[model samples]
Target: MAKAIQKITLDRSEDIPFDKLELSQKNVRNIKAGVSIEDLANDIALRGLLMSLNVRPVLGDNDEETGRYEVPAGGRRYRALELLIKQKRMAKTEPIPCIVKRGASTSVEDDSLAENVHRLQLHPLDQFRAFQTLHLQGLGEEEMAARYFVSVSTVRQRLRLASVSPRLLDLYANDEMKLEQVMAFSITNDHVRQEQVWDTVSRSHVREPYYIRRLLTEAAVRAADRRAVYVGVEAYEAAGGVVMRDLFEQDQGGWLQDPALLEQLVFEKLKTDAEALKAEEGWKWVDAAIDFPYGHASGLRRFYGERTELSADELARYDEVKAQYDKLDADYAKAEDYSEETETRLEELGNELDRLNDRPHVFDLEEVARGGVFVSLDASGELKIERGFVRPEDEPAGEVDDADDGDNDGNVGVATSVTGGISVNGKPVAVETQEEEDDKIRPLSDRVIEDLTAARTIALRNALASDPIMAFVAALHAFVLKTFFLYGSDSCLEVTMQSAKFGQTQGLGDTVGAKEIEQRHEAWGHDLPKTPAELWDYLVALDEASRQALFAHCVSLSLNAVVQPWNRRPAAIAHAEQLARSIGFDMVDAGWTPTVDNYLGRVTKAHILQAVREAKGEQSAQLIDHLKKPDMAREAARLLEGSGWLPEPLRLAVDETPAVQSNDDAAELVGDNVVEGADADLPAFLAEDADSEDAASEGAEVEEHRHLDPAE
Candidate 1:
């Protein structure tokens, strides 16, 4: 027969008066934790006590029960009740529920410890669903937050988590997915899309929270994007555009889902703004776009507008500030050190007077009639209107030759020329010129001009299509036009090349590639002529090497291999691979390392281990494998330094043949083998911890094996 099972006896519970329940010193909880006493009291006062207090009868000196109980386990709940009585919300005689411990073998401290330790906090998924349940039961977010004593945002965050794809929720519930990953999935409400992203990241070695967010919002425009800021999120939503938000993390103003609509709205708004600006400022022509290429202002005649005269009040203020500023400046320069307050005051006074002096700019009437405007969004997303740019064709007449005048003597009349600039002190100085009636050249009739140009245009097209050399040159001309002109419609051929803009990609501007491009762009900008009209002649005059270099730069800027969700390009990416292979490109050689910030921190702990195992060895990986994900990543980064361990995305295909993987070798990703030369592989912090006995033991173990240094 099986051993007879012992019957269990639970402590009896009773409704004891609040006044009779006394606090016990044997309670183990002395430190404060979650949910403040005041908030808990308020909660209890609102909802009444949910859990009963665990108490035992207070014994006198005679070992007889006193007419009172002492709480041991539910001290916090007891305090909550006491607080309600103190606040006069609950009466002293109010009966409180209590679980009576009668003649228990366990000590009061043991009971208290068991109550807190043996209990399980509610699972995150359960808590999320609880909020959802309360919401479905007609409770508002504020109402639920009030009931739980949490903030409204906290309740909403939980609700958002609960509202995630039910499949993902189930995974979270089953502990198959992390809460952070679940939060990332909550950015979008499209269940199908959410599940799809989950499926995609689930297979990848790195599924960090941020990476998940990036993958989900790849096609969407960031709310901080110039276009999104120009077209406010409210207007985008009003126009039926979806904005995906992350309640758990800062989304950098969130993401606008409807990119097509956003683009359309941005374009329409920019065009409207340009039209309004042109009407207000009397500009001849206005070209509006989301962005002009890098060297758009090249080859244009830029004229600064005149500042309006200051008002009397502004003038007085400027004078007052300037007097104070001048005195302060003299004192500051004479003093050995300046106070922060003094420095700040000087800056303030200077800025104030500067603002007063820098009045609104107004273009001249003649400039307004002859010049044009380029309208677009600036880096900060405000409407940027660049005015008073005179195109080559719109420039005023140059010096008139006396040979053109039939009645003039053979005398060269030295008149000022507006078309050409004179170098004075190495700077181009502008001299205003007046037009002469004799110098004006009359145009032919429109029909006659069209007839002459039509023949030339048709013949040119035929000539370009036949000669590959000229065709290349013509294509190069269009690329230059597109790359350097705000309105690049100069080309007769329909060929277009639009460089990908990466304004929203954080830190991209600071990248090695970006810096090199900027340097090259600035060099070319300094060398190029004043206007796009002269760009063709300049290109034609360049040597073959110079032309090829410029050509390569223009073509390189147009190359975009970014993988976007809405803009999938398998063939293009493959073509990029072919190009890379031809050039023998390597991201490692390009100066990319698996630092904690860029690679290791963005991947899962397993991926970090896998990388270390591959680059170093199983033994080297195991040294840091037992650490937390963040710590592991940092150490792995150090271990893999100069090891050239590239992620799959950065890896180039050396051949068409697929390399085989090993199952048995993969199983040794985190083994306990001694790392040979592991002293060199371990980080300084880990190895130099002389005070840590654990570190000493690890260091000794590392010394046993000498040839498994991860960095090597």
Candidate 2:
């Protein structure tokens, strides 16, 4: 039925029985009663009542209180308004706007029962109270629903919610517990057991309703004593207790002292078990906790076997030793800072020594001389060789007679003894020596020459390889000659010849080749000899191209290995000298040794002279004449003769000859009556000339007058 609007005043002083209210306590389910009363009070004070109370009239026993009404809803709003009234912000005389159901003659007991059961839903605690009341009245679920106008299931749920222990119910009331948790709590009929579960949950800070449900379900499955122990263990671990192996043994035997202490002992035991398991299996505590919570205790007992108790004295001594060791470690760490500079210097020195050791050995003349053979210079300036027993003519010529003496020689000649051996350097040396002795008697000069040849060959090969043009030239030289210095007896001559070949080949007979040669000479001074030997030396000393070519070749070779393109010019002679040097020949200058700047200037001057000749031929005679004209003072008539404004014939005539003045007595041409010849046109010409002279004089006078006027 639609609510009838009514102006109803709430009696602040009236003590209306809460039971008489039409609000249903069973329906008063927890709804996160948002915003505390204090907050709501503030909201009410700021904003007046926003909603009216829904109520129905309560009939007295014999119509004595037929007009009395009870609120069906808006209890919260009614209380807020009542507070406003008490605070005198709203007058008591002002009636509160209300929605009423008229002629609803329901008894207060029936209304109270209806309010508690049907009109207003109650909190779980309130529902529990109502359910107990109705249950005490011996009302069945169906009868109670009929009285409250609700479903039987609804009554059962409320009754179940009510059956939860007061401690657990308080969790619901405070909004700490959820309906699902209350339902889960209602699974068991024992309040003592529920309280124990609640205590476990509260201690463990396991506020999740789902976890609570799971715990209840788990408790239902396990034995009560085991469940209690598990709860204690969970609570103990939650409280930061470390359960040991001994605690588990005590727990299994039912020797738990205090319930809380049992939790504490189990937690303590867990820590000891964690340490033991970590030591034996390398399992972390968290991993162990995940693997086995209760079963871990059994594993711990089996693993530990028996606890090895440590005396206080032993622990103290161990702690002291650990402290001293830690202090020493800290001191050592501090000492590391002090030695860091020395260590760094030592490391740098060690690296420097290693680098120095890695370098090639320096040339050792003393060591070369110590091998019985000595280095000597020949008359031709070439290195010479002498055996240990031989002496050169320059060495004071060791006494020949003494060398032949029988006492000095090993062999003795008794009239027919062997006397066929030659005496060398004061020693009698056998001509036909043993193969081993002969092999050991190599000349020092020959060895020195051999070593020098090897070193030169290695250095040249390295230099050639480092420079692409030089390498190409070297290879080409070796290819053409079919004999490298390293392979020939005259290695030095072969090397010199090879270098000459490179120079000749690189200076190819072409303009581009010439330019490249010129450029090379420009960069490297032209004073460098154009000989093959000089070119080879130049290439060897020219480290710039070598380093660049080395880098380029390295990169190109690396890239080519992956991307094989056949067109790549791996050994291109970019410069003419490179090709010339590579060909192992001299760059013959053709009797023309032009420096770069000189050659360029000569070519430029030739071009400029050719252009001037061409311009002189192509230009007009007048333009050329104008060019030839001197200063204005020197050739004032030439300017007038060549002026483009004049007729072509007149200009040509005036320019061809000098202008001549006519005498006054020669002819009085026109009004002046002057005539030089009896020519009929001459008079007109003179007159025109006289008139032109007069006009010129007048114009000059006008200009002078303007100037004088300015001065004045």
Candidate 3:
């Protein structure tokens, strides 16, 4: 036809006995890849020759037929067949379907290369759908994994991915969605919710798997939460509460789907447990709550019962342990360096001694009967039973012991107890003494003592002021005694140090700053003098360096930068600002930053917007202002994080010109410009919105002026 097209004939295909086939050395695949031989063999056994092997007839040097074939392409399949035959699962002479390539024009290497390289892999979505079908058709995950030569987890993950909304699955199939994103959607069974979350995340800038999970579980309670831990997952499930889990990641416990049901179970279980404790401990009343806020026991009187007396056996064991500990400790001290065996023995002995010393207190039967207990869950989810709490109204009336039983007072007769009288200042003193009013020596009344102490303190202050060195030393002494001593001190110079105790601020105890403050306090307390009277002498003996260190610590304790909502002391706050400027106290250096739980999330929308606008930009603030309060707060926190922006109250007071960038300088200036009881500093947008509202509402807003310092 045009030069007469050559008649084309395809390779002949036929079934050849497995025993007649031989391996070809010309095969291009020298290195192992893709599925293993064992898995391929299993797959072949289960599905049986899905693809035909390519074979060429063997030829001798003379170019004559040898009645045998060599496989070039499909080498893995040929190996799998050989394995099946070796295992006796298939007959050696069994017919194997194959395509025979003939003629010298076509090379075995070319065929092998084409066979290996031209193949296309099955799409992941197709695999997922097929696995899902198999699962729906009553195939177990393990069986499917074995049949497909994959891990059981892989099979489960594929199935989970397929179970999401068909729309999302379609998107995944169409290559518009990531596998991880699809896996995130597989966490929930609600198809509608999966689609909704997808819609939201698809349009959002942050479409990571974690963000998807967060949005889905925004309303759900974490399994690690106090309430969830209190009611365990098994119990929650038993109570018909569903838990959503991520099979693709380590979801630290997972999310409880039904918060209502979880809370219900938690409260019910807590109530039942509380009742059991009440019955066991014989408490007059039992108060149970999910959370008992810090200082909940402020007004409640806490009394300790006498420690239970040790039995003879226990006392003997304690003595033995104590003796061993003492010997080991002394030996270790004598050694220049620690010996492993000796140190270990000392530690063991010390632990044993401590165990012996930790004997439980034995409360009086009457007290136990009248007192109550607080039943709650600790951070570790264990039952925290605070016992022996006697309410003020429930206290028993005082009973007077018989006065005439002894000498009207509970005292031993001096004449019977003493052999000789004591002398003071060369004057002999009577064994029996009584307080008597006299001109030279009279017992000072309480009021007189107070007045005298007040006068002495004034004189001391004046004298100390005149002598700076002495004043510093005295201040340092008072600080050291207060910090290191556990017992009440009678130090003439009283330096009132305030612990960073939170009252109006919620969640303050859980802050990092609070923990550091507490640790510092404890460390100082361990080194301070225990007795108040000895405190003055100890300070006097301390070196100048130690005195300076103590002075700094005491002055730091009196620093108050807290901006409470109800109590807004302008003069005090202004002075605190001035102090900050003087000391160069940088809040950023203290590691304080904007966070959802710390600052941004607890403030108003206006404040959050202001923070973002200041820290990030006006555009960043606008991006989050349209969201709901909680969402906006969370986003604002993200934008403002690490920006080193501080509220007006937390900023340093500016003096003259700043030597650095003026981010904090602006805050200081704004703070200085603020007028008391006026909305003079309100943002233009806020002011505009306020004008549209009623006058009464505006007045209310003015009265409830927000603190410039966001002390969350």
- Highest lDDT: which candidate? 1
**Worst 10-residue lDDT window, candidate 2:** 293-302
Q: Is candidate 2 or candidate 3 better by TM-score?
A: 3
Which scores greater on lDDT, model 1 or model 3? 1
Candidate 1, residues 1-712, lDDT tens digits: the string is 8999999988877999988988999999999999988999988878788899999999999989998999988888888888888888889999988899888998999999999999999998889888899899999988888878889999989999888999998888888998888988899999999988888767665578876787788789999988899989999999999899988777788999989999888867865676677777777777666655333443456665666888888888788888999999999899997599998898898888877866776667887787777666766798766676665556677722333333222111111112122101111222322222121222222222222222222222222222344445546655775576433223334444454433222333334554466566645765676457998999999998777677656555545554343332333344444445544456676666677755566555766777898999999987876665655776787789999887655566445322565886545532322122223322222223223236766576456422223322
> What TM-score, over all chains together, does every model reach?
0.56, 0.18, 0.68
- Model 2 agreement with the true structure over 123-154: per-residue lDDT tens digits: 65786679878987898989777555567877
Q: Residue-pair clashes per candidate, as listed?
A: 7, 56, 2
Instruction: Order the candidate numbers by TM-score, best to worst.
Output: 3, 1, 2
Question: lDDT tens digits, residues 623-674, model 3?
Answer: 8766667777777766777888975434454454446767775566433233
Evaluate model 2: give its TM-score: 0.18
Where does the lowest 10-residue lDDT sum fall in candidate 1?
A: 410-419
> Which regions of candidate 3 are displaced past 4 Å?
1-9, 85-91, 322-351, 396-505, 509-566, 574-593, 604-606, 609-629, 636-646, 650-712
Cα RMSD, each candidate: 22.7, 45.7, 17.3
Q: Judged by TM-score relative to the true structure, which candidate is superior, 1 or 3?
A: 3
